[model samples]
Target: MANKDWKTFMIPYEQAVEELKVKLRAIRTEYRRKNDYSPIEFITGRVKEISSMLEKANKFEIPHDRLAMELEDIAGIRIMCQFVDDIETVVNILRSRQDMKILYEKDYITNVKPSGYRSYHMIIQYPVNMASGVVNIIAEIQIRTLAMNFWAVTEHSLNYKYKQSIPENIKSKLKEAAESAYQLDQTMLDIKDEIKDAQKLFEVKSAIVSSIMNDILYLMSLNKIQEASRFQSQLNKLIEYGDVSDLNQLHLLVRKEINRFR
Candidate 1:
């Protein structure tokens, strides 16, 4: 009966989580539309389950009445990035937001936890406009690289399974894995410029392929079947020979073909 009541009380927090997730995802969409690099690879959020909340309250010896005031992470958001430096970019973006006030930050990345946990955690006070009135809720945001998230996720599962008493051997292995993930992130950062150039080439090639396909369809619709076939055949050869990568070069080729058809 108490758990049921707690679930009902958590409705606002659940709404907050969903709202924040949508907003963060929209930021990612904005970056892609501008053909810009986005530090956030993805966003995920969740409201704490009643049982988990209760467990945490009990662990902290919190009275029932103090639960709401003390529990900051009832609403949580996680942003995953591709590189460790990207985590700093994400933090800066959050800090610049006017909608939510950043209460404080915990830099676990610089000073890793004894358990080998590493992430950047921020506590923010977000206003959730209610029908009755505006209520400010505290939400915790954690940012991590893909590799750091992978290790944290695995470690979390093991902690749950062992109830925080993981075997020594397993713990050692996890520590090693965390170190390896850190090294991998560093290596990626070292070659980030090259990786970005390759990605830009891919996007350009994709755009050209899509434009060529549309042009082929337009020609076919105008009963220019022979012209369409010739254009498509040449396009296939160009793609097969790995010729279309630069946007300017693709535009030149497409312009010549388009002028011929028109």
Candidate 2:
């Protein structure tokens, strides 16, 4: 009974949120295609106020303004990225846009509010054209890494459920978790170069081995057993070095083993 009544009140504000999300998605898609950014991780939206609904009554009286936003996310969008650095690149793209007016800027990453919260947030006002009419919606953009998002979602759920009055000990634990996530972000960026190099080397070695084996089989098919056998030994010598560009030192050692194998 309460849920049904809440929906009637929440519907107009909810429509505003849904419309904002559609606009954000269109903007993001345009940027990605224009800039050649592919394999995007995630894009999501939320309208806030899970506990209550917004109605004409929810609209404030007096100097607060009646048509003004009261919900946390009068409109909201979350942009998730693979790399921590990607978050800034995303924020910058939006910042440069003329259509989106920045109402507020909060750098939770650098200036964490001591609530163990971390994200880059921008409160923006953009004119959204809806079937009903054109409305100016205040949208909040949260940019963060997937790891940060995971921690935040957990923290938010706990906060809402417990009314944000978590025990002191638990609050300390949440701070530790946030710090850990920060460390993990730094470490991943540091190791990314090495990881990419290793993956490339692994792929190159696999392709070379397959090519060598095919060559050896072709020699055998032509009845050149001696040639095929010698080439097979040479291929074995090459195998140990994998995809190494400088394999001369390893080549010396492998050649000795290759002769023995033959």
Candidate 3:
């Protein structure tokens, strides 16, 4: 393809990556807004560079005309989770979504790659409305725990550095690291409930603090300088050594002050 043609070909894939990132991030935001535990810790996406796409095409013996159909990962999204079990929750959520059609799935977590890579992969067909018309594109989604992502990223860097011919000693070390990462994930899963409870408490305290600060700001806006100053002093003390109950009490006091000013 010509240079201009290649640029044009990538437009929809770029759009697909941005749109998917926004939609997936929204899911995380929605969970936080409702004070629920979110399976997705974060999301990232990218469209394949022209040089990399060409290299892959040449390696796989794919024709330029068939690139869109054969290259499943030209546009990719990665979802990172805090625990191993959260991967399943995210996969089920994607399965139930109506916006994209799932083409198939690859469960490397269960199967275990020879290189010890672990992740859940899904290929989906997503439609993008262009000025000319709508085009359906293939995109790949990978869900994995933070440990797994770390291992994968390190492995990828080494592969690039060594030109995919890593020394056997290095390969063995990589395998051991992969197992260690998996063990860490398993341990985290065992204590998931305790971790979640702690996180919830922190979030509740944060919400109360936010409410108190907002009320103080409102008092200032209403020109109740003395009331706002009093609350601010109390808040400074609470921030240093206060529990949720203390913060809640302060929040209530600030709210009452704001109401009185009104």
Candidate 4:
């Protein structure tokens, strides 16, 4: 296809990536709103560049007319997790979703590549609405822990620098780094519950503090200066030494303080 034609052809894939990123990020927001720990750390997405796509097509002997059929990763979404166990949670979440249907899955975490590349990959068919009509397209979603993603990025950079002919010493170093990353993920999983509790406590404290400050400002806005000051003092005390780890506890305390003002 001509350059203009290729650009036009790529618009759908670009849309797919952008839409998928937003949808995936909403999952994280939902978890935070519920005061729960999310398995997904972050999400990123990209549509394959034309040059890179052409290169892969040639390498894989894909014909020009069959690029869409052969290139499963034309649209890519990456989901990063904090713990190794989180990867499974994310995968299960995707599997349970009805909006996107999974075409297949590759469990490279259980079957690591020889170059120490490890990630769980899912090929899903997503429907994208275009001006012409709704079209079903294949998008690849990759799930990996933070450590695993870090190692993968470093290794990818090295591979590009060496043109995929990395020297033996550098390859060995990459392998060692991958192993260290795996261990780090494992360690995080060991203290997962403790980490989760700490995170929840922090979220609760922040929410309560914010709500109290907002309420004080509202009082001041209504020219209730004395009431605002008194509430501010109470809020300061709570911030200084509040053992609140849940929303209900914070709400009860704040309610009592507000009742005193009344």
Candidate 5:
């Protein structure tokens, strides 16, 4: 028996991820720029694994001079979104692209895998021009929530540890744990707006504090208390009431501080 020449076709993992990222961004940016779509929300591509390679090799024999795609990814670019509604938005984005061929889709969020794993997967075929020639490769794109991904990571580690012979007790415990994780993901989604609001407050406060310190650096020098106090009225309100929505209020506070001091 002769050894198959898949290596010639198999791209280095780094280059494989990089090329796909570029390909995705190129088309997406063009679409948004041409159509004037605001708030670009989705990102793509991630590192691959050896298991992915073996799987592909076994699935399809490579013709001479062509590379094989092995898409074993552990951290696999799972997009952790804020809304249950956005999953379809991401899927539609992928479907609309002319450069990509939608191989298949499984909506595990609506119809979860029997093991409790929830995600949307598509075996997309996209063209990449390699040194050999133009080639199309299959990259499995999975859309999921941050909580879902976290739970999945923990579950995967346990599966590897137990070597698929998970003890009955542990299996039951894990099933409960997965349910808890699912509840957490749902809770997070339910409070997505609140989470975003809190995150914005944190970002805004950090920005203002840094800005105040920087501005006071020249004249105030090491006067920490005065500098902090200088923006006292504004800082007090922003940080104390972290959970805010009105961007206008924040903007006005910043403007007042700059006008008063500078």
Candidate 6:
């Protein structure tokens, strides 16, 4: 493809990446809006670089005309999770989505790679609305725990740096590090409930504090400076050394004051 042709070719893939990122992020936001833990901690996406795409096409013997059809990762989305179990949850969510059609899935987490790389890959056909018409593009979604992602990212950097010819000793060390990261993930899983509970408590407290602060600001806006100042001083002490119950009480008091003003 010529330079201009390549740019034109990438337009739909870029649109697909941006659209998928927004949709996937909305899932996380919806979960949080309901005061629930989201399986997806975060999402990131990209359209394959021109050089990388050309390299892969050459390596795989894919013809330029068939690149979009054969190159599944031309548009890639990575979903990062806090726990290993969350990968399955995210996969199920994607499978249930109506916006994209799942072509196939690769369960690398269950069947770890020889190089100790682990991730769940989903190949999906997503429809992108172009100025010309609607086109279905192949996209790859990778779901993995934070530890797995960290290890994979390091491994990818090494592979790039070594031009896919990593030294045996370094490869061995990388494998060992991958195992360590998996172990860390497993250890976290063992205490997952406790960690979740702690996080929930923190979020609840944060929400209450936010409500209290907003109400205090409302008082100041109402020209009740002395009252707002008093509440602000109390909030400062509570934020420094108070628990959730204390914050709840302060929030209730602020709400009552706001109600009186209204």
Worst 10 residues of 5 by lDDT: 67-76
Which number leads on lDDT? 3
| Candidate 2 clash pair list | none
lDDT-wise, the better of 1 and 3 is: 3
For candidate 2, what's the RMSD? Answer: 9.4
Poorest lDDT segment (10 consecutive residues) of candidate 1: 243-252
TM-scores, all candidates, are: 0.90, 0.61, 0.96, 0.88, 0.66, 0.96
The CA lDDT of each predicted structure is 0.87, 0.68, 0.95, 0.87, 0.60, 0.94
What clash pairs does model 5 have? Answer: 9-67, 52-70, 52-72, 53-70
The digit string of per-residue lDDT tens for model 5 on 32-57 reads 45643312245566654545545455
For candidate 4, lDDT tens digit of each residue in 132-232?
A: 99888899999998889999999889988999899999999899988888888888999999998888888877877777777667667667788678766
lDDT by residue (tens digit), candidate 1, 25-63: 998899989999888899999998788888999999988
How would you encode candidate 2's per-residue C-alpha lDDT over 69-173 as one tens digit per residue? 644455577888766777888788788988778888899988886877889999887676656776666767888888789889989888878876877888889
Model 6 scores a C-alpha lDDT of 0.94
Residue pairs with backbone overlap in model 3: none
User: RMSDs, each prediction?
Assistant: 2.3, 9.4, 1.3, 2.7, 5.9, 1.4
1-262 per-residue lDDT for model 3 (tens digits)? 8999999999999999999999999999999999899999999999999999999999999999999999999999999999999999999999999999999999999998988999999999999999999999999999999999999999999999998898999999999999999999999999999999999998988788888888888899999999899989999998889998899888888888777777
